[model samples]
Target: MIQLVIVTVLLLVLFFGIGFILNMLMKTTWFPIYGYFAVVIVFVVYWGNAGSLTDNLTEYSYADYIPAIGGLIGAILSGSAIKALRTRGFKMF
Candidate 1:
């Protein structure tokens, strides 16, 4: 359990670190884009390691894709909502 927690934290740090790099490369200050990139990176990492990580559980499963789909939906919704609010001249408070 402790190992799982440590690995999880390390993965999160990696995701955010990559996100920060992407933000710098794109020259965008918005954090939502970075958040989305973090999710993408996590998903990619999971997919890449699925065979080894989930070998004992199963070879293939739809559950593995849930995180990727959820991340994509969340990013899209957040981006659209922010765009809509900005266009309406409303500040998020």
Candidate 2:
């Protein structure tokens, strides 16, 4: 309930901050989105708890997914923000 909401918001802020810094340093748009996916894949593989893809997908509860979705949204937003800033002549971004 409340914990889930807090966790989701925390993940969102965490991802956004990380992605924002990465974009600033790398000067690449959309890299954070790809990085996020790569990180998820690596974590899944490294944990070795993965079954078939469908099984893996079905096993997680909403509690597991909601924060992840939030984080993904954050990462995407960071990229968009960076792109918009750059477009608007924010050279540092």
Candidate 3:
């Protein structure tokens, strides 16, 4: 659907921004990738368990994590590419 596509594009842009910030602060190519994965795993786990102490709500299905994973991958790739380009004397505007 169009809504899904729009949401996905927004997520990619947001994640890429996060990745870019992380790269700028960390100054390491691999850190953003690892950091993104770690954050996603923690987020999914926490979200899945959010209702554990409540009225016995069910956890999210695996499919629910797909978008987050996709976003993380997009972020990692874009961030690393940006870092590489900047290091190679390319100006990002």
Candidate 4:
């Protein structure tokens, strides 16, 4: 369906855009993959429990917002994880 296509594209952009920004900020490449994966995991969680939350966001149209939320969560998680890894002497090469 067109909706699914749009959702996928938006999710990819959201994930990649956040990842690219973090990669640039930290000067590393792996962070992007981390961010992307984080987003995917979050999306999976949301997908698993859509009815519970989707009903609350009645103002919004379409379920694609789930991935957008995932992207935001992923961005935050990615930043924290990257920082934590660096603090623990994990070097990205």
Candidate 5:
């Protein structure tokens, strides 16, 4: 649906911007990726129930996955961008 697309894009941009900023501030290329995974793990731990791992993992639909994929791509791109900038002699500070 249109809403799903919009939400996915929004999440992608949101994560990208946040990750980019974090990279600049932290002066690290891959920290955002690690930070993203840590945040996801924390979120899942907070929202998941006492059920089995398979049951909990299977509960999410494409609607839940698409945005996460978008966000992950965004995070990855952010790190790449920062690395590229640094390699090109563009200081982040």
Candidate 6:
């Protein structure tokens, strides 16, 4: 509902900010996309194995992971868009 929309927007904005920071740090447009994907995969695997390591048996369904994955996608897209704009000679102030 409205809450989901709000959260989605917030996640998008947050991830976009992260993407901007990554762009500044990495200085390579394509690297962040692959890096984000790798990071997400590592996180998912870590979370999936958390229960075994902690002996608490925590569980996460797809719903729980979607937002994080979506955020990563948003970040990658944001980085790519910025790269495209820069390549096209767009100026940012």
The candidate scoring highest on lDDT is 2
Q: Which run of 10 residues does model 6 get worst, by summed lDDT?
A: 49-58
Whole-model lDDT values for every prediction? 0.52, 0.87, 0.66, 0.61, 0.86, 0.67
Poorest 10 consecutive residues of model 2 by lDDT?
A: 44-53
For model 5, the stretches where C-alpha displacement exceeds 4 angstroms are none
Per-residue lDDT of model 5, residues 1-93, tens digit only: 999999889988898899999999988888878988898877764468847666667878899889988999999989999899899999978
What is the C-alpha lDDT profile of model 4 across 28-90, one tens digit per residue?
A: 746766656565556644566447655535535456566565556555555666667777887
Q: What TM-score does model 6 achieve against the real structure? A: 0.61
Whose TM-score is greatest here?
5
lDDT of 6: 0.67
TM-score, structure 3 vs. true: 0.64
Candidate 3 deviant stretches above 4 angstroms: 46-63, 90-93
- TM-score, candidate 5, is 0.91
How many clashing residue pairs appear in each of the predictions shown?
A: 0, 0, 0, 0, 0, 0
All candidates: TM-score? 0.42, 0.90, 0.64, 0.42, 0.91, 0.61
Over 12-89, each residue of candidate 2 has an lDDT whose tens digit, in order, gives: 999999999999999998998998898876775445466676667776789988998999999999999999999998
Q: Model 2 — TM-score against the truth?
A: 0.90
Tell me the tens digit of each residue's lDDT in model 1 across 1-93: 565555545554554455444444554435655576675556554566455645533654555444445444444444555556567886543
Best-to-worst order by TM-score is 5, 2, 3, 6, 1, 4
Candidate 3: tens digits of C-alpha lDDT, residues 1-93:
566666667777777777776766666556767777787666655555465523222455444555666687678776778778788997644
